[model samples]
Target: MSEGYQIRNQSAPHFLTFTVVDWVDVFTRKSCRDIVIESLKFCQKNKGMEIYGYVIMSNHIHMIIQSNDGNLSNLIKDFKSFVAKQILEEIESGGESRADWMLKRFEFAAQSNSRNSKYQFWRYGNHPEEVSSEKFLWTKLNYIHMNPVRAGIVNKASDYLYSSAANYVGGEGLIEFELPSNPIIDVLRKERFNFEIDEW
Candidate 1:
């Protein structure tokens, strides 16, 4: 398969989605979820990445992020590597004994590829969709918020605990979210896209 599209603008922010190997539901476990959260925090502190919005789903993660240090790729690469190592360590330490069957399943999937070290936690392609237009940005934001609702996990988007939906809904959340720039919002408005989505 062809590689996913990349938008490498050193000066502009971008939206990115990275999936787990074989679409594994890794985030179903709190340990796995915590690994991702810790990685994000580490990036925020050390990688010069400003995370605008994010949603941690069952097998993938979506984020509106940017790097001011001109190494967005490296930031993401390190973040993924760190999380994979931590999650693998947790698995090896018997932290998720109940997931022994799942661990075996992951091992089986990892065997299908020769590139991984031991077990592959995440896939290689980080299908990045650049948010150059306001309409697209708002659409992606709404999509991220509505993911839980679409998955039938929650009746309301804000009810999902692992996403930035609560941040948008005036509730306390794990990450501090900032509204996108006025120019971006204005462009979205001009395109006649509704930022406030009430239904799927």
Candidate 2:
């Protein structure tokens, strides 16, 4: 992981990516995807996670998020830990047809990381990029929403059931999230009519 990608401002919003080990398409199964969704909901409710936007792809997830309690790194660490165990258990229970093959890969991935006891599901590093400016924020949000479209999984971003694009378009999303306001304007208002791009 590069130093630039490390989470610095723990309370600030960041664009994050969570990829499966070996880029495995674990989320092709709705059951697997649902586990991630429910886990994120749990974090939001109990861990002070504030999700700005997100999309779940076949092998990875992209999210715009922040920690309300200013402990983003710990919050993410716990989220990944819980979700990894739940999904591994689901696969071990024969919920997936490719369970054996997937488990072998996960086990192999775990061999390199001292943090794992049996399997490794998520890859190391979140690739977190702080949401530094209004332009950068919307750029990441657009990229997240357009993932399914770029992959041809959906013709329109809003048509994807596992993304916040639906909520962006005034439809309901599977998980709750806050619609982001322009960071520049929000900063300006909060600072009594003064704003610096870096202050975001």
Best by lDDT: 2
Residue-level lDDT tens digits of model 2 in 129-191: 999987787678777887998899887778899989887676479996767766454453336
Model 1 pairs whose backbones collide: none
Off by over 4 Å in 1: 1-4, 112-114, 182-200
Compute the lDDT for candidate 2.
0.85
Model 1: lDDT to the true structure: 0.75
Q: Residue by residue across 120-179, what tens digits does model 1's lDDT show?
A: 777767777777876677778777877888898998777887888787666467776566
Q: What is the lDDT of residue 74 in candidate 1?
A: 79
Tell me each candidate's RMSD, in Å, in order.
Answer: 3.1, 6.8
Clashes of each: 0, 0
